[model samples]
Target: MAAAVTASMQPKSMTRAKKWDEVVENAYRFQLAGYRDEEEYRSVKKVDSAEKWDNGFVKKLQRKDGCFYYYNKARECSDKDVPKTKLYNY
Candidate 1:
């Protein structure tokens, strides 16, 4: 199970996000909740998808320890965080 999860979550390549977008926003949220990205989050939580707002922004995320983090509809990924957020390719 662990091997399969790891394999499925492995990224073919990764690059620092150059701008803020929906993808980068999700990466920030996932990292905050202690997952690499949405794929790993789903694998660990066994969920089909993360909760999202109507605008397509993440609405909530559950951490590894089972705590839930809620997000507002506003943009959470700031310009300063753009360089730190990683964009992964499968």
Candidate 2:
């Protein structure tokens, strides 16, 4: 019985230690098209959160269509002519 309790508590402790990553990934995925499908969003959220550690924070991109995209600003395209890039070039 004590072993069962210890095993259950271990998972919860691990989850608490990694909650931040889950939040960031969820927000990121939502910004991306990954959340477009209701069912897929739910599943993706779970898997993504598990893979990302608490230190992993996803950056969001401001899209031209008034929506957000999931991308790291450092790696994003800087060309102004890029239609899918951010509306504001500078």
Candidate 3:
């Protein structure tokens, strides 16, 4: 099941993203929702996957409080935010 896969994907070490890219963008999205990444998000939210756009960017996310957050079609993660985004290694 999805839960088993997510559990196996847990990170062993983490580091801040040095540049802006798809991976950093995803990390930014997850961190904004108070999660480490997609795996953590799925585990906490109990969802199969985060809703994404046609361009493959995160489209919507629900926080722990049950509030939903929507993202724009454009890139949400900027150069200034790159240093704040964490990249996880399994």
Local distance difference test, candidate 3: 0.84
Tens digits of per-residue lDDT, candidate 3, 1-90, equal 335445577789999888888878878998898777888788777789999988888999988778988999789988898998889998
* Candidate scoring better on TM-score of 2 and 3: 3
Candidate 2 accuracy as TM-score: 0.21
Ranked by lDDT from best down, the candidates are 1, 3, 2
In model 3, the worst 10-residue window by lDDT is 1-10
Model 1 C-alpha RMSD vs. true structure (Å) is: 1.7
Candidate 2 Cα misplacement greater than 4 A, ranges: 1-26, 36-50, 53-90
TM-score of each: 0.91, 0.21, 0.86
Clashing pairs in 1: none
Q: Supply the TM-score for candidate 3.
A: 0.86
For every candidate structure, what is the RMSD over all alpha carbons to the true structure, in angstroms? 1.7, 15.6, 3.6
Q: Candidate 2, residues 1-90: lDDT per residue as tens digits?
A: 223223322222111112223333444344354332222333433333322223444454333244555544332322332332111110
Clashes per model (N, Cα, C within 3 A): 0, 0, 0
